[model samples]
Target: MRVLVVEDDQFHASYLQDTLAEALPEVTEIFHASDGAEGEEEARQGGIEAVVMDLQMDRRNGIEAARTIWAERPQSRILFWSNYADEAYLRGIARIVPEDSAYGYVLKTASRDRLRLALRAVLVEGQIMVDREIHRLQKQGAAPRNRLDDSEFGVLLDLALGLPDKLIAERRGMSLRTVQNRLLSLYDKLGVTVDPEDEAVSLNKRVRALNRALVTRTINVETLEAAQRDLDAWLGGRG
Candidate 1:
């Protein structure tokens, strides 16, 4: 099987290549791309049956690159190898993956045997493999009682970025009232909803909600950083 490894770190890339060569005899040929943009291009050129994608990369992130690759080739198997099991990364992957495609999410800290197992499961066996920690976060995030839909998550990102309701509405192309409503929904899901008659009313619901989210690990520094990048891009386009 021909495989492509997309990683920004040359050392890690070389190590992965060597490991695959030594361990997985099925991986006869391995290609390397240093960043997500190059990775997407390489995958698009065809002949790569599987990809070992790093979640974070310069120019483009793994989620964006994988989305494009899957758009062109829905059957392509991808095993996400990353140091982080951030909810943002998981959500991004969950949002774009083709329903019938096989995929895997294995952490960088995984044992060599586990990595080999994940690669075989995704590439050869056409099975899904998610790291245990990542799977726990996935289940927690998808729980019905506290689940945040896509729109709600978008607003939450804007809130975490300290964007006011008016600015959020402007950025999201919604009315101020709609933005406020979404905030209320976000607060509800985060379990930070405040009652007007209660002493908690003195606290800012937005701040409270963000704090709760951070404490629960629903959103982390990486998620906020990704949001900031998207916001910067949006602002750049406007200018």
Candidate 2:
């Protein structure tokens, strides 16, 4: 597989390239570009089997790059990787390849293993690996706000990771009540203006949605597209 990586951050770009090389040795060569502008140039030149690009870049940005690449090389698959679930990231992807085909998206923090799995699945299996975090957060619903200090954030993430409050307290040195109070605050920030009437019902819906998304190897492409464009506008200072 010939891989094209487009990212602006120097460290992250190198790390991504190295991760792919170490894990996917079957890949014959890797082509790297600094930002969306150069990425578009490289894409126009062709021969790329897959593209792993940052959705945000200095000059042109990932969305524009993907749009350009798609116009030039429709056969080439793209495995988008980014840190954000923000709007800019979504819209960047919305413009390119219809979600029915060989394209994938994974978050930046996804383990090297998941990244490789997503890449192989797309390049070989013709499927997408929606980031597990996407499933995890979407399962519980978005946090109303990210007000947790690092410690509180850790506790919140513990909930996302399915740790019980008692265990979390034992692990983090907080009392069980303290843990519960913090969680209530976290839920408040997450925008639950009303009390949760049915944890079971909400959990059931989330479980089914996430499971279907994974097993079907698909995702909310439409939502992602809309969000990305909105984020871009904000980042661009329009909002």
| Best-fitting candidate, scored by lDDT | 1
Quality of model 2 by C-alpha lDDT = 0.65
Question: Model 2 off-target regions past 4 Å?
Answer: 91-95, 139-239
Instruction: State residue 225's C-alpha deviation in candidate 2, in Å.
Output: 12
lDDT per residue (tens digit) for residues 61-89 in model 1? 78878888888889999999898767677
> Weakest 10 consecutive residues, lDDT, candidate 2?
213-222
TM-score of each: 0.72, 0.56
Q: Sum up the clashes in candidate 2.
A: 15
> What's the lDDT for residue 28 in model 2?
90
In model 1, residue pairs whose N, Cα or C atoms come closer than 3 Å (at least 3 residues apart or on different chains), thus clashing, are: none
